[model samples]
Target: MSDAYNSSWFAEKLTDRSIRGIALETSALIRAGALPVGAKLPPIRDLAFSLGVSPATISEAWSELRRQKIITGRGRNGTWVSGDSFVAKPERLASVGHYGAGVLDLTMAVPDRALLPALGNALVHAVSTEKLNSYERSRILPELEADVRRTWPYEAEAFLATNGGYNAVYTLIHALVPPGAAVAIEEPTGMRLLDILEDHGARIVPVVCDSDGPLPASLRQAMLSKPVAFIFQPRLHSVTGQTVATRRMAELAEELRDTDVLIIEDDGLADISDAPRQSLGRVFPDRVIHILSYSKTLGPDLRLAVLSSTRLIIEQIQSYRSFSSGWTSRILQGAAAWLLRDETTAEGLKEARRLYQARRDNLVRALAERDVIVPSGGGLCAWVPVASEPFALVTLAARGIAVHPGKKFAVQPTHHLRVATSNLTDRYEEVANAIALAASGG
Candidate 1:
């Protein structure tokens, strides 16, 4: 409630009244020490009147600052400058993978390196690609597109290759969604997805999910906010490992029948999952954007993922890409194409699928023996419920085993642990015993 830094001062200093401009200028003032920490901001209506702008504009600017942790408080409580730092990071992704030595890290849900197919022959085959190192902005290599089309869930109007799965998602959201636009996503989704949405200043409306998939009623309720897009993992959810059932997909399609919200299906597991891929693209081809990533099945170093959608949407995403990394590497695309068609690669993937399934089943069986039952869904991790997230994390850390807390992947209250099983090949019984004790809060 300082009179020195009041509405009149902000109005005089803020030449640009747009949302971004207001947030940026206010942040600068805070960093310059003009607006010291604990300085209360003028109410939205008063600031709008002083600047000759709408109250909503000022409100949005404040929201952006809040997301960055620069300011705190809202409504009748009054807003105050909390911090000077403006850089917002991926909180969940940054917090994991920092354990000390001698700790079994089960936090990263990545594929086992030993199981990945050899890339020597594919690299040699890529040397013969049709267009080698041209500066042209090709959406995708012809050979790669043709190979992917064979197993695509449905006929898409166009396709674009990206650097990776998360890159494809980040680009699409930045290109299509404006700041503060509502986005509907599954509740217990990948932590990185949440980070991307928050970085874009999106208003996330979480759709709750059951074992089958995102519940129709929850999706129907989220639609009330008119989200611009709905993003969900179509096969083998990275955290939960559950596949959306075919019946659930039909019901979801029915729920979205009348709306124009873009359906973004992220098939990150690719062919690694034994379950067949499913998508809403079949029902609404014009409105669905499906992305298939090869990082899990193929090597992560390749960094290739393909997205298919209507020509207009694809073109928009491509246009955005022109600003940075105009196109994915043709050599990598060629290599992926060769591997997809290679019989040896196919056999390796089949064997990898079998091995991953066995590893996951082993953990599930071990946990069950300790009276802790969890679904053996298809993915690299297993979601085991716990009595308390804090207690479970502390107990597991004491045992030199590190696992991700369930709250990291949830927008709502949840008590569980996402334990990686892809590399849990040898210590199944020992790890399961630790998990069992953690679940019982011992």
Candidate 2:
């Protein structure tokens, strides 16, 4: 939190580019860990004078860095490095367990191959027709933004796209929840989401969930600490697949009424889920931040998502993005727009939804018959409760079936395993047998 930007580093690293060149070079340095944490940046005016650029250029660069959460400007106190927060968190494959050759890995909760549209074709179609231009002209591709607004489930005043679902969630958190402030989140939520919140230095107040999603009582308890924000995974609640019931959504919205808590809704699975999409956003229009991600529909590689809410919050996130990451990849945005809007990916979308629902329903039914309880929250993953989670994981692993332990998803220790059904085709019988055997110890 100390001001640490020095002019000497920029002087040595400046390239042929102007103010942006300076910013980009500094960002590179930050990424390389050359600019240590707590390092104070040179005063904006000082840096501008040193670089022989207008103060406005330096101001623009600084705005970008601040929006990205790479640096924090404290006005008279001075600007300091906050780059450690942006350092990419290495994927925790070790905790989740890596797969060996020939192992049936169903660990990641992602859409099946049947689900992803012909991305290559869509990208080609988009690139061939659309004129390439600088994304700097607009933070969002006009067509994609329109499509997002067109399909948005809630009555949002405005919309903004982020890098992905996580980034959208991160932007909401970074924008509203200050460091050390307690923020309420679902107990058994997305594992990566928990890591993202922790990384941003927020106090996680866990609100335990049932098959119906977060209980009203637990949420009421969480609100007492006067949390700055609350993140809810309304539909396809990760390991559990628990969507908040319509009645519960109303009740929760009522409780949040008049409260300052910003509701961050991660509705990334709406397209693929069999369950009807319901959101608290409609009830609490002013308080809700709705996030929709296309990775589950298109493919994870696309990494495109949008955040919708009131204009103020959208503008704040937009402002941060404008200065920091600038805009989402135009090529990716264009391809997504073409795929979703055009006739090309329409059949693919329907097939993906139908096939995933079938797989999830069958898995849930099969597990229920085996006395292993897990409800299909209309998602790709089923949460199967086991007598002994460790033994079941070992047994299943021995059977060459790799699954993610449910403990990873929960704030509390869990006796359940999240079974991913993305690749369960002919192996449904075999996989079901392994899971039943693992759970029953028979």
Candidate 3:
């Protein structure tokens, strides 16, 4: 690499604080072979001096590339380009290789199936004993509606059950967010939701987040464009595992109240947060469509979630649901309602929370021992800053471990990897050992 750092691309890309354009440019060079195999990256100080940015920023970019296996740092040997064979891509299915061989799975987010008892029995009962022969009667069963209200804590009239959390989000988008309308989401957000929102005709707008959550400056800019809604995981955010601060939550509520913007708060793992805050729905119930699911708490197979809004939005969304799903399955709805009321179900949630917290604690402690700074725990995932996302990913894969590259969650490039801890049951020690191997970059 030349001592004369190319300033053009870095300056242009650094305009967006959250988007690391320069790092991405460097990644492309590595991919295209312009940065030859075993070639060294420019020193951080020299690169920063040339690019007119802080050395720490350049260090972060280099670290992310190292983690992804695009570059290798051999201590005083300096960072070198990983061979072309090392520039591998991740799998289509997320979290496939989160665990090393002979280790517990800590990278996936599904709950233990054993915790939730005999859902099949409940499903059987729902199918055999329903007296509501009419579609309307079965679909809007009083018992089912009561159950939805209990979990959501919204007026019974304003709630509806959906196929799953994803379905609930699609329903709201179909009913409220018009095609091509601007929709703002936190950068490094959930990929599944991002794809769904785009498919439903949303013009994506990303709001950058910090330790405190979405920066107010980002929100201020996003609101200027008149987005239809702002989607956020207010409780346990997906990849970063950072909670939305209470002060920022109040500020956001006030900001949205003064505009026509709606807030879609995904509280999928609300029960797991250390300090579970009230839903944005509770603060401004009329303008927020709150979605919650038993997937993270119970298990993904449950495929049941509640979507609640003001009576106005509920009536509007009901029309869309009728045209789309006709109605959520009565049998499934009954089963979810029954599950929520079960004392065993509540106990399972408490157990899941404890397990996840412990796993995260173990992960942080392990990573810290290796000189890796881990983000504070919000839930099952940990966003650990590293040297090069591609480098780390490849090195880990060779050692039979896998992690979600942080760039997948980014609206653009930011040098980090989100290491999930949910799958690490009794074998977390083995998983930690594998991570240590990757950190060693052998």
Q: Give lDDT tens digits, candidate 1, residues 1-442.
A: 4777789999889988899899999999999998999999998999999999999999989998998999999989899999988666798898877878899999888989999989999999998888798899999999999999999999999999999999999999999998779999998999999999988989889999999999999999999999999999888898888999999999999999999999999999999888887789999999999999999998999999999999999999999999999999999999999999999989999999998888889999999999999986878999999999999999999999999999989788998999988988889988998999999976
Q: Which stretches of candidate 3 lie over 4 Å from their true place?
A: 1-107, 128-133, 137-140, 151-157, 426-430, 433-442
lDDT of 3 at 189: 83
What's the CA RMSD of model 3 in angstroms? 12.4
* Models sorted by TM-score, best on top: 1, 2, 3
Q: Write the per-residue lDDT of candidate 3 for residues 161-219, one digit (tens) a residue.
A: 77778778877888888766899999878766776765554678899998878888888
List TM-score per model, in order: 0.96, 0.76, 0.72
lDDT of each: 0.92, 0.77, 0.70
Q: Write the per-residue lDDT of candidate 2 for residues 1-442, one digit (tens) a residue.
A: 2333456557667764475676677777888887877788888777777787888888877766775678886678888877764544524333777678899898977777655777787688567534465556355677887777776777777777678898888777777777668889988888878877766667789898887788889999999988999888887676677778878787777778879898888987767765666667787888788888888888788888877888888777777666577667778888888877867577777778777778877887777777776765667788887878889989998988899877777667878888887666656767777899898744
Model 2 misplaced regions, further than 4 Å? 1-94, 128-131, 135-137
- The better-scoring model by TM-score among 1 and 2 is 1
Candidate 2, run of 10 with poorest lDDT: 85-94
- Superposing all C-alpha atoms, what RMSD in Å does each candidate have to the true structure? 1.7, 9.7, 12.4
How many pairs of residues collide in each model? 0, 8, 27
Residue ranges of candidate 1 with Cα displaced over 4 Å: 1-3
